[model samples]
Target: MPIKYIPYTPNTIEGQAVLDNITRTKRVLRYRENNEVYNRLERGMPYYEVETVEQVGKPSDNLVIRGECLSACAYLKEQGIKVDLVYIDPPFASGADYAKKVYIRRNPKLAEKIKAAETEMDIEGIKAFEETMYGDIWQKEDFLNWMYENLQAIKSIMSENASIYMHLDWHIGHYVKILMDEVFGENNFVNEIIWAYRSGGASKKASIARKHDCIYFYCNNPDTFEINTIKERQYLDKKFIGTLVDENGRFYVDTILTDTLMGVIHRVLDDGSIKNYSCRPVLNVSKERLDYSTQKPEGLVDLLLEIASNKDMVVADFFGGSGVTAKVANELGRKFIHCDIGINSIQTVRDRLVAEKANFTVKEVKDGVNLFRNPQQTMDKLSTLITGLQTKVEGVSNFWLGAINDSKLGSVPVYVPELIDSQQKLLDIPTINRIINQEIQNLSITAKKVIVYYIDIDDEKELKKFIKENNATTTDIELRDLKNLLHETVVNDELEFSVSKEKEEYSISIDKFISDRLKQKINEFNDKGNLQAINKGKKFDPINISEEGLELIELISLDCKNSEGEWFSSTEIKIDKLGYVIYDGEKSKDFWNGKITSKEKPLRIKVRNISGDESIVSVE
Candidate 1:
């Protein structure tokens, strides 16, 4: 006999729109997977290797990557890395903005200047501030498309025996349930776990007070999936009036037994009565609190990790807000990879893990772009372009010589022109003369030769006259097209950082941060009509560097001597006023002292800037 299949359709127009939206998004995702632009981006993206502490005998290592969740997951897929468990706490699309409280140190000299400037002050002699962390504002269609694409990428990296947990709330939980069905298949749906809490704040209007979040659990394959049975003990103190003792000296409550299960109950409930339940009690503030707005409790993640994964298995969390999943997984002896776009989120995780003496590497994935392909304006951009070119050339062979900024081909010093005009102009006489003279003066001990790369020459007559007139007895200048020499490829720039220990206390600082992608983003904002300018420019300022680049910093946190996975903040610095203190590192000497331990052990530092960008470094 032949079977017939029927397609389900919604009855209402609004409902139909929802279905059409998801269907359209899935098609677009497939289209992008095959698109040329995306293909090039995937090929040219950079991977950074940060510092990490390694255990003496352990083979596996933990990871904390900084990038968009979708891009990060796609990179993982391309690298052939698979995980046994996945858990995500993505934005619920609740149409709200989240902010972080900031505190700045109070210098007496600075306070006097503030008072002189007629700024108001509180009696505490410090200032408090707030900075927006991330936003959850999205059009319904856009939100659905974003979630669909991310879920698709996530599915590509899951093993056949893996399970995934999607955490959501009242805002878009129902819609995501349907989306999950499409991605993981309808037959793989397992359970809808409700996490009820009592942090009461609800609308005073007509709706019922919401006190729970929904976690949808699904597996990659129903036949091969593995899950451990979780059982809780019910004490037989007083509730069971009619208690009975079994042959093994185990006590149990006597209840009406069914004929089909009479023997099963006595054997299973040998000691304490067992309860198979789903709802878990809410977490109290006293148990564990990181002050993160959307942070999840460790106990909640513990239960899920216990049931879904085992020791030495790979676990992952892409929307790693508070890093609770990584923390719990590490405690359970499971390997973890956590990715987050927010700087504060990354900083929180790094500081927490470092204090617990957990060993892990921090890496960054870059979006591909050839910054030197066009006219360069800023000195920073020009420097970055030179560095990129140097890396590309050195990988093939030792074709270039000298250090990055002062590189040369043999004895000939190379010079790249910086033009600001929209129309590519020819190399001017004065620019050529200046380059020749500078090279002659810098390398005065030896005869010098100059090679300049340009897209166009203003005038061949002017260049010839300058070269002939200014060319010294032992010097020669030549011009070449840059396009013929440079081709885009995947590059990884490893940042340098140093840690110093004094009297058992450690201090860390970054030597440099290099990102051509970040520079491109800044240039796009400076120029009008770029789409990202309309999107991300509204929130963050373009990249800027000064004396120490410290002005761009937002927060710094540390984890000193972590032995377990539990993250405890050893010290944190914020760009606000509340962090100010007296000589004892407190508002008053008599107040509670929360000083970091001065012990010689592994150390980690997380640095976040005002633009919501983060970088982490560690030393063992």
Candidate 2:
């Protein structure tokens, strides 16, 4: 699929003026309360330690959550769960869509020439397909309000001596630092660490190349907080020239290098136990790479953890992209909590921690965003379900999705609650009051009607009566049930298999597995424009699916339970990027071909595709 790469930067000089004015005044970040983001905590449903499952990890009380961290923090604060350290890399309000590269699994049934060529091409560009994981697009003022709420919620659950690190790039780091100062207190502001990397695009001669990301660190209480001055040999570069070896026959020297990371390039020791690490991006050839988009290097997290926290202290990462924080925390003997808003992130982290034998429990919040698919797909489907709902409109405020034009009524502004955002979805008194007091005043003066869409309403009769009693806008107000407008067909992948009884064991034979989503992605890939393929400077041979859809299977597991309530992996096999199998969480190459035999009775089987879509099949 062709990716629409949109570069994000400040559009007008007015934005610079606004920022400069804020800097000239008091050191604080201010923004419009666009959607009443702080009210989301009231409607948030908390979920905690629902159940434990059998997985490949050691026993510990660590957690991996698949929901919004703000809600999770609310629950943690109520339960008195205090975190000593936090390192989050939240979205930087960039108007860009991020995608993950999907690879086609190698097939033994295919010809040797095709398999060899495919394996060679896997080193770099031109993978099988790609799918959007999430979009980091947001309005400038609205993003600040959202970040402010998150900071307040996170501060409530931090321990007395806790510390936090907020990672950001050139987009909005300066503004977020001011917000951090307001929430954490200006006196508690500790340090701002600069991590220089070479991942972004080089400058085009018109401007200088921007490459570093700022990490704003703060303490809950500077008086009680004690940060360790972690020793590194690189800072001793000039000192090594005038010093000699100590009595232990060992000397430390900061060796200088000119390759990358200009400051304190390397280190050396007389005992040959040299330890050196550069603040860099995760390279493709690095062993710590999991191919997850926006994944940060482990060394980056290590340096922060070493300075801020100690062993056994609770460390939390709200924007846990790929679980690098949780994995490193567990490795460093610290308890951790990993939370995010994407299932793909949860799955990626789960598998990584499992492979490392790190103990953690999986969790999901009971927010209304719990849907059949992810939030991105659900949001995309809303456009088709709601007729004439415009997503973009000029001069019309974003407070409304867009003014839906009606033949009878000239223009009606539509208000739809975002499924991913829990704070603004429920149509309650706060939502209604905002519409009347805050939003209505900003909308186009010509708009005579306003429509509000909602999944659940708080006291609909009272709300309708409330709107009638406080009709200040003189606009025809209508409340529409969001679910009532849903009219879409659904299809599921068909899974067919067989189970035979052997000597005190059950042997499961995979007959056929079909995935609709994967097939659709392939079709979209082949439908690329001719000019786009020509830009490749080589012939683009289309991929044909002839293996009965076996190439789509990335994971297979049997939850051999008598009844299905909670999922448990009794026997499992996962195909890696190189076509190797991880049987029962054990990596193996050229194992028992396709047929998997288990000594226990198979109850149900779970299959996951290479695109991270999963489905379950019952054998009863």
Candidate 3:
């Protein structure tokens, strides 16, 4: 008997999680209005300047929003956008950091060398550096607080009849299951469809290798909601598994009855065993592989979409990793919205959908603060930019993000909200009180003062007056606006390219490229030989840049008709990991020549480097 109920309900604690937790009745947190989500929304939900208006085969209303999903959902809710079906593979809170293997583009000499030799087909040979997409590290309390708000944000834009499938592993699924129950109500719970993967490997030394992921399904309206019956897919010869159809003319498979997800979910059930599902992980050689670590298989999403939605319905995935949901939805004739905060994710999904001729508008979320890439990068950069902020706070709890060593005050505790989270940006009486009396009350009494960084304040005067009246803690407190400490830390890499005309063909040759940041990262990596365990004693190979930095270019696109505003790539070329040029819609086995010819008269051109930093030049 699997224990579906935990005696200790996850979020049931009355002020058990955090003072700023969200419940069904209380959706908003303490002055969370100060968070960037509300701050951006208050600006009249301004449409993030359009990055692209991609129209491939047919005109589609699909969207790829490049920003935090919570903020994007807020914008969608404000814009009157309603989604009928949603599937989000959000962070599992597994305390693991996922990184993408960054490959350096090959120089022309190496390209020629590889093309000349038949054996040089390995693309992983070009592992330049690893770029972390996002860190899933979180404090359990903060995680719950953030998730409660995230669910509320997502629920705001969902239609009355909308259904949501939340994909998570055993790590924190059980806890969030309780959350879903509270947010969507236990009555709307449809099914816990377990996505059991094909691969299964458990270890005796460690715990069983949990291979399956749990997908909790919920609907806004149970009375009207209906899940379409999906049968085993037809074979190449168009034969069903059972070769049988019911009176309603729907195919059915008699042998496969279990709707389960045992292959990957690692936790032991009450019976001390796990179940399995039929879904398989996307293999590297499969066409579904998008080179994104967090990318899900199309088969999995396809099954879910078919079950939960009708054709041409509005589908959405807030935590859209590599755009699998959007891609599968587009293929199935459904309008889609793919939202992710990573630039790489946005670009990858755009290319994937564009190849299929899917239409979508790419929009950027205007996070006025934090000029850095994403939350993880922003936090990491803050660790260095903040002068006296100490990183080592092992003894202190998560409430105190870090300790600032002040010469006058000694070790002053700092309470900086994780910028990646949309939950804890605002500062008000409740939040200030929590910081002073509740959470940080446990801070070391020896600390002379505490520093709190807030993105927004409900009312600074009111808050200060309240704090002055209610300062019960022994240590003094100081409030600092998180935005004030932020300075532009992003490096703008230079580019050199030329355009020439040859009759109908306008040849755009990228002569050189430079990314001082990538070069610096490589130097730091080589200097601080902190290689993974597998390469403990091996000699580390240093990435050498040629005088002409043409090797840095990974992708090139041309917008022939438009020079500004919205961009639609009429012609484009991409350098795959194998160092081969995928020109327009075709991939050539021959190596790249560092020059591409476009038929459309080039108005503005965009070039993306191997590190995923894009720079554009207008054709004069």
Candidate 4:
């Protein structure tokens, strides 16, 4: 009996495994204000924004709403924004620095400590704290857990046929792969691409310095996504020895044969000599063939984009650290949404987009607006707004919703109102005429400042008549002599930097909170150790503190531990201007050598033995 190759189907028992691979979550953060969501939509109102904000009676698009990602995902689902592709490059537990001089917090308490350390260190306060607190200890598990929580939200928002590319490195690549298998179903697992790159720097002391990272590709269901193929640069094993041409206009080693115990014979072809053998179950082709890079190349992104099919497909990146996937989507004319908790990652995306001259519209506003606030209030306000306009306008544009019948805002999709075109005779009515006339007046007034688009015109006469009837007076309105104006559409990509600046204000506040907390913690440690008084005469060198160490302190209180992996009793050690160390008896010995001494250099104090030797060694 011959074995038949069966195509993988997502509907089968095996297929169900893929869909069931997603992780489940119980609780997600909810916001205190609905006004934030509302205000955000209003403030950043685009002339013709993307599908996310292009719903009926949406609030402001100007707000930067941060809440439970799961909740936001729920709203997106309600909006009918089903993602087709998701690429998450979330935290890999590499302790890679994130954001503006801060590392992601593994321990909430440690996060609190780093915040406390920020004040006394001044400009170097946060740095100082990280050096003291997290200098030695690296928390790999906490980072992974934090990342997984966010990924749960990402997974929930994807379509059944969607694909995900989770980028990782050696740091925690293997662990994440296991997690992906568990979440995305083992059968749904696709390829593990090793993205190789060449670096100028050589790895001298170590075994082959790593120059590549792992990108795991998985689908919600097996064989449900688009696969893009590329042409090989050249043919493999060109056995075109002696004018060997086939009907297909290609050359091949026409003689490759072998015989098996089943009485099957096979032939093999060599350049000048013939080779044949008899085997149990004979095989014919023995030539090794190569087409392109066995490993997926960097161009993999372009190929994936081509397979996506839909022009306005939703492409999400929850682990959007470098943002290559998003950038590729944008370049390929696909709409993308990306997010990362890391400030540096977000900044990287922003910079790359801008540098590529990718078109984007952004608006910023203050935080108090509460855009993604109470979901109920948003629904109520939207109801009132839509109701008030129902009798006033003719036909609501469905450009944003495409064919989706339902889309939610807050937790409810905008109620799609039945639309009817205003009758020609209705233009004669004063009340109806007044609204039309007002719109025309507003259009005429703003035409010079912005592009004026006219739609639904068969000829010049209709255009002129419509304009005259509505009292629209604008030099920019091209009186359509043809039917093309009927299909007129307009979009805008203007940036309001002021809105961005205002949005930055809230982030700055968050930053300050982190700063204040770090400083406070540092002060507490200093006071407990009685190092504050000694600081009066001591000159501190900035270089002694490592950037990573300070980050750890800011993230968590720099709780120092001893050589035995035990928390050391807290005490104060003071340094004089001449770099003299003073501690209460053995307390000073704990930091410096066994005795208090003066030195010109800043003492290197190791904390927790996370990195080098010593829990907290002071060097001068």
TM-scores for all candidates: the values are 0.52, 0.81, 0.81, 0.35
RMSD of each: 18.1, 7.9, 8.8, 26.4
Candidate 1 achieves a global lDDT of 0.55
- Which lDDT tens digits does candidate 4 get at residues 1-620? 00111111122223332322322221122222332221111011011111221111123221111222333344454445577887655545665332122222222234345445652212222222332211111355444444444455456667888888876778778777766675677788777766545432246895678666677888887776655532221122565446454456655444211110112222232343322222121112211111110112224454445544356676775545456666767776677665532223343454345445454422221111122112222222333333222212222222111111212311111112111110110112222222233433433122221112222222445544654665444422332111122112111111111101232221000111122333444555455445644667664433222223322221101122333222222222332111223342221211121121212222223221111111233222
Candidate scoring better on lDDT of 3 and 4: 3
| Full candidate order by lDDT, most accurate first | 3, 2, 1, 4
Clashes of 3: 15
**CA deviation > 4 Å runs, candidate 4:** 1-72, 98-140, 200-206, 234-300, 307-310, 342-620
Q: Candidate 2: give the clashing pairs.
A: none
What's the C-alpha lDDT at position 230 in model 2? Answer: 49
- Per-residue CA lDDT of model 1 for 264-352, tens digit only, reads 12212345545332233323333455556677767677777877999999899988977888888988899898887654666667656
lDDT of 2 by residue, 1-620 (tens): 00111111112112121332222211221123443233222322333332333344545668887767666786676567889999999988878888877777655354244444654314433246777777788777667766765776787788888999999988989898877766677788888888888767477889899887888989978888888654455332333455545345555543333223322233343465644555678878878888888888887787678678989999999999889999889888899999887777887887887677776678676544434345666666666567887767665687777777788777788887776554555577667876887687777556678889886677888999978876677787899877655324134577777889878988877777787767876887877844468887767777666556766777788887645665677777877766667876678654224556778888888877787777777878
Clashes in predicted model 1: 13
TM-score for candidate 4 = 0.35
How good is model 2 by TM-score?
0.81
Across 412-513, the per-residue lDDT of candidate 3 in tens digits comes to 888877777754555656567667666655764477788888876768889989888777667788888787676545656677778888888989777777
